[model samples]
Target: MLDFHMVYTCGYWSGSPECGLDDAQQQKLNLVCRNLNLKPGQTVLDILSFAKFAAENAGAKVVGITISKEQAALVRDLCKGLNAEIRFEDYRDTLGEFDHIVSLGMFEHVGPKNYRIYMERISGLLTNGGLFLLHIIGAT
Candidate 1:
């Protein structure tokens, strides 16, 4: 059940019509890592995202925050022996600056009332020249 990089969220299916779920997930992960330019020993905030992948593949030290206990546990297990920490809490309560931040399909829960605050916090948590990758689904 944990195969295919343990992808539990949306995948990037924009490439290769013949690609399967694993390929799509790989593509999405690769795309994000490339965009963030993940590097060795860099600090990253994943907003409860693909931290294990980044920590393992890029040698990044990642902190992933989520409101879900299940997700936190799963990520903690997946990131075992890596430079990754999964926190179960509100993102607003998370502290510290990061070299890069990435969130995939999480902005939908930021409720309008807290949208501005959330964005502000994200900005505040970013170090100078840090990159942020926000991947969301468009409702049409």
Candidate 2:
């Protein structure tokens, strides 16, 4: 049930055949993952995960957490192929560490008041020299 909804709403059910997302969206996502040059066995944490697209394309284990439990379950079910784990918690509440961090479309939620805190948490979670990717939308 949860998986179905995620596959549909998280831009997966569009039936585009390229991971179910638009070409531009897929290209942007693939570009970022490829630029990272992730190792095959790396553990990649996807902050505020949507359909697990980025994580899946990276060929790494995925740890996805979302503020909404439903969202987490959806991602968990959607990422069945990849080594994926889903948790329900505010990003601030998550404490586990990872090899790499890829956060997409989540910076807007941090706001100016919480940006530093968010960065610090992300820093804390990453192992030394581990890469971090922060993808956000710029204001008009």
Which candidate's lDDT is highest? Answer: 1
Error of 2 at 125 (Å): 0.6
Per-residue CA lDDT of model 1 for 11-49, tens digit only, reads 778767797887778788888888888889999999876
Model 2 global lDDT (CA atoms, 0 to 1): 0.68
Where model 2 places Cα greater than 4 Å from the true spot, the runs are 1-21
RMSD of each: 2.1, 5.2
Query: Cα miss at 134, model 2 (Å)?
Result: 0.6
Name the regions of candidate 1 deviating beyond 4 angstroms.
1-3
Clashing pairs in 2: none
Give me the displacement of residue 111 in model 2, in angstroms.
1.2
